[model samples]
Target: MSGTFQDRIPVLLVEIMRKFPEERSESEVLLVHNMLSSVSMFRRYSGTLQLLLARVVRYQRLERRRVVIKKGHWGHSFYFVFSGLLAVTKDNDGSSAFVDKEPILIKKGMSFGDVALIKTLRRNATVVCMEETELMVVDKEDFFANKMDVELKREFDYRFSFFRSLQLVSSWSYSLIEQMADHSKAEQFRYGHVVVKDTNDMGNIIFIGKGQCDVLRVVDLTSCSAYQRLLKQYADSVSRGTCLPTHGFKSELTNQPGSVIKHKVLLNNPPRPPRGLLADLPTSACFLIDTLHQSSTFGLNQYLMPSKQRDCRRFTLVSQSMEIMRVEKTRFDKLVDNTTMKKLEALQKTYPSDDELCTVFLEHSRWKDYKHSVVQDLFPHRVAPIRSPKTQKQQGHCGPSQVLQQTRHVVNRLKQTKQRVEPKDNKIKK
Candidate 1:
């Protein structure tokens, strides 16, 4: 068995070399044609396949336990694993520390580092050879010029068409969109899976690529009976030294945001109301106020902000078995020029202010004693179905959420109006 195994290695290498064209030297082919045929992405461009195999691809061998790629460095080539095993590891947070996760095993006949063929982005993970390995590699310049650019163009026209339709990104140039498409990664989530939780600091900007998700906010509940119990205790109570009912129970419920002022005022002067208090006081309420669907985006504000500054998530994003595309903030920042940034700033102004959101939350909490609809109008009904322009033509009508369905259209009109007024103003000044 040992002798056969040793003989197999030389035979395989010889076979790979013999497959080259008669005119070209044996060293020139560098890879087996059958291996290239296995990659689905490369199959469509058959006319240029042989040329790509000859000019770009090369064969390389890695020794056991050798690091082939390191995290945080720019990737300039795509690697196809022909034989042996590899281990993949990445940092937990965008930090330099990589001890957070165990290495994932990748076996033979698979490929990795495909993103390197397009954009010059930092490697999110490190790849190391687990044993003596054979690989077929394609470097960036030829890969993009000959093959990947064509695939990326079709991808932008289909699966990622949402990037072009986006009102906020409409002002972005074609080159900028191409750069973003290169750096963005497609990811999937199962039902009931939490994509992003409150207080999480993942710096990637997420755009729903294909499905739906629920935006949730976890809130603590204080039952109506608990509130009334507190009120009754306060009415009957007094200082420990005084002859008032000092033995009544003290409610230890957690405080809500911005409650310090309310507490101070209540201590200074108490309002005595008649006995029959409202029975329907909130036991609990929705803290998260929005339901984002396909094409919806988040983390852009944080992405635009400086990296050194601390930022926290306000809501939790739980997927309903969806697919999403996310782009690293650092990659976007590197690719986007000053002109693109200015257009993005103009687009940002069109969004409803963050101050407006805070006001809505406060109003909703205050109206908890009234009908639910009184505050419900402040937010959209649910996740709105987002279809691309091509799909919209095939589909008959929009889904249930009227507000969300119209929100993007309204924002686009606002942008057009703003531009019109600005040009007129410049003419008037002249």
Candidate 2:
């Protein structure tokens, strides 16, 4: 088995060398390999298949405003972006008028032209370089020869199917949906990953292609009426010497007579609620505003409303092992008509305000604390005893210092007992 494995190594090396074109250096081959792995469409293929693709791809650099492919033309080759941006448009002549339409952009790590080649049909859209672009081109003959058409076809079908099922775009024309499918890329995120942060200004219109996610808003509990009531109750309990242990409080109060006034001032001016992303806050502060399932959409409100009218509350979308399709807000605005835009604006749901969510959270938290306290009072024996400072010190199994302290304590107690017994024996003898 070892000898057979050793014999296969040279054959594999020779095959790799033959796959790469003679013009490509070892460094260039490695660069192409990295590019293929980074691109979503090509990343799913096996290492051998990727290597075969890297072999046939040729480098092409085009200046800004150059037309890579025009609509109604025969599909000649497949193109993958290595750097810079390209715009996909519906214009047949590739005129300047298309620029006003804000066409969908294809950027680095993105690929296009597969739809036309895989279907063996004329190009349905025009792709023009928006910036000086570096592209890796695979001619139609080499693309088909390597059977890459099959994989490209599968990806195109998957995207199309997903877009077709979406109700938001159900009224859209078939061609428009196909164009969207060509531009949008699908991405997967693990559970608890923040797909969109609260502070993001230029957010993408996201469609939950698969799995679930939560829309959460961070609320300031300190501002709510319920929180104020709870705070007042806590203060009252402290004043009555009920909730807190009295041993430390008595000494502190004796040492600092004005501490009560300072405490009240501190309560009145609680530190300003933390500002920034919801992901940075504690989970308790983040309230679930909505749960998004497959086919649900978010980040549309920004496009539907003017800047001033848009909701100012900060929120984030966290994934639960989800697959999402993201379209740039600018691209989506250009894709749909005014009527569809109006319909989407009407469908936007209003979420609970921070003040309201804060009130609810405070009430729920209070009830939970009440129930726990009642349980401890009813079943006192079942509640675990809290260790005292002295007991905690002895429990530290860290080093010899703790053991020496414990020994000294025991010895001091024994000396005190012996001294008391000696005094009592003297009185009895007298």
Candidate 3:
């Protein structure tokens, strides 16, 4: 090491540097720099990266075909491919099959085993050397103690609660939920932001952690035309001093006359049983349908089904200042367990029939738009508009005194919930 080369060099060509007998001793430092530069996560924490490389990382040599990692076992180390080739494979059915499914080749300068380490979950795939290989590995203790791992653990813990709130994944165990959180990332959108444009283009499943979204499905002209017809009839009834039938518009309109105008309005709309009134739902009534709220999930159904037979997202998700968690489709497929899949299937089975779902949508929309407006008119003075806490706070009204009161109220509520579910430990799982 005549003149120390502080700059980083390629991992594969480290041997070429060794040829310079003078700089051979500095090869270790060069390799560490290569690892840090190659990984984006490491780049974020240069100080910690340097310290870990110097203190914890160790070089290991493996013969061709030696298993570096095994699926289903707890992940203990994060390995960086320092040199030579490796093959990555996953078990399809968790069986002792000698053959690998969907094998992937990992070459020099690449990293694997970090996903499992990030979540402190079981390995989802196995990695084996394709030839005599050199790897730089940081064991679990050192890996998790790093600042990057701590940050990731904190994020995953926060995200796990959102997964628990969702119906599709609510029943999953903490371990599985943690894995899902590992693959997900938080995203924020302003009001009316189109989260998904073309059905085919959307690649990740979105879970609403906070706020609302309008799920608009493309409807045929016939459906739109029918809804327009209904709106026209309802408008006519309102003008003629006749009430629009409630019970999701299933009842026939009554004949009512206004003061001596001698105007005759024909009511051709027939009365039908509630189940037969699928046309009443907002999905059938308008070109766009607004639905979904906190804890709702979209895009999974498309991913789970085969491409040739997959049902494209019939609905477009437009958010309103929504905070959400999104997991990529490829990651979802790799991580979702059988239990979660079964739960999703069960949820699909529980979906209301087309007609019934539509009726429910109609009932909900009617309550929000028509019913509430009529009620407000009847008791204009009595209906003191309710103010949200957020709105109040935004007006510079949430002072220290008000915050104290809110804190007490929230503490009381938490006391009750805490009786049913104990608080999770702050220590990161490994």
Candidate 4:
């Protein structure tokens, strides 16, 4: 793939090279090398990306500290830093820091405003030039300019993502990974702040792309008695990999590789309860994130907050950020064996595949249905999930007696809850 992309890359590079202003040629080559050298993550799409790079126009060269991409402005092209680091920054919220002329630095991977371009929404954060930077800008015209082969281009896009995830962890297959990309969020919280109490919605998977957090129990903030007791009960039992109670909200520690953990699902939030009252003990908001570098700690929580009007804005932005990353999701996709594929299909779990899921169906007949296992697997060490009766037969090779036992566990819990509530009803009548 590298040899072919390199062979064909020069041809495409010729056009852009000839047209580029002589001053930025060295910078352009640097960007080309960077794109070419991404062998592991982007081996398959190297050819297409090489072409993508060639068609780009090397526009104006801005000074080191120039404001390149402004927040909320409509941007259409992709830009690369040929040399030097370009800081992704936004204004501090009308605070003293802003008056003092200090713009906040966003983390390196958190590219500014690309999601707006892809989602066709407004830029959410301003991207400023931190140092003297050389940039290559490619617009929609450049994107659509080369009409070499659309079919090949599309296939490359999907495979590129597959390869990216495959490279991350070779354990996953495309079948396990298909339709695997789901809406996600990057959130931040102060060290002591609670992200979510120990509760399990049994929906959505959590990944700590950056930073870390501690897993705590649901305790009453107002009452010391209950809080101490709850904390004491599972004081040491809830290690990172340990699963939360089947009935409680699910979460895990992040220090270890495969631990059950939960994060606030910012991409989608359940409509707030309308009773105009808080739940028991403030739900003991769990301070799920335990670590943060000065670089990543700030801005994440604020970014995930729902005020963005365009709710999908964050997902699109992060997706584009992931796009510039240019990794193929191949690793996770290939991990999809009968077990993983069945689980993904049974749960109807959708990850950030874009159009990649379509091909997954063609690969396996069982891919037609969603899998609950895929969702559970996604959450690191999240334990065996509670499956619905309808999804039971699809659970695959299960012992009937065990299935019946698990079925009773799920059903009897509901019955016991009803029985618990009956006494409360009688007491009210008396």
Measured by lDDT, the strongest candidate is 2
Write the residue-wise lDDT of candidate 3 on 368-390 in tens digits: 45665686679888856688998
Q: Estimate each model's TM-score.
A: 0.39, 0.54, 0.37, 0.29
Name the TM-score of candidate 3.
0.37
Local accuracy by lDDT, each model:
0.50, 0.60, 0.52, 0.35
Q: Write the per-residue lDDT of candidate 4 for residues 1-430, one digit (tens) a residue.
A: 1122332334444444557433346556566546444422223234545444444544345555567766667767655443434554455222222234645543222323433544466666656665545455656454555442353345545544543443223446444333343112223333333343322321223333334433222111223444334434444445544532321112111111111112233212322212522222122221111222212211223222345431121121111011112212343333345554443333221121211211221111122112334655578677676899878654433232222222232222223333432223221100
Q: Specify the poorest-scoring 10-residue window by lDDT in model 4.
A: 252-261
Steric clashes per prediction: 0, 0, 0, 54
Using lDDT as the measure, name the better of candidate 1 and candidate 4: 1
Between candidates 2 and 3, name the one with more favorable lDDT.
Answer: 2
Residue 87, model 3: lDDT of 79
Better of 1 and 3 by lDDT: 3
Which candidate model has the greater TM-score, 1 or 4?
Answer: 1
* Tens digits of per-residue lDDT for model 1, 1-430: 1113442234454455444334445444444454455543343233344445545566677777677778887888877666677778774232222333555766665667876545577888888776778777777776666665675556555534667776656767887776676656456777756676552666677888767875543322232343445445545553343232211111101122212112221122323333543222222222223445777666663444455752342456666778787776677667666665665553221122233223333333334324334444565575567889997653433221221232223233323343432233221100
Backbone clashes (count) for model 4: 54
- Tell me the lDDT of model 1 at 17: 43
Local lDDT at 263 for model 3: 11
Cα-based lDDT at residue 362, candidate 1: 32
Candidate 2 residue-pair clash tally: 0
Superposition error at 276 for model 3 (Å): 41
TM-score-best of 1 and 2: 2
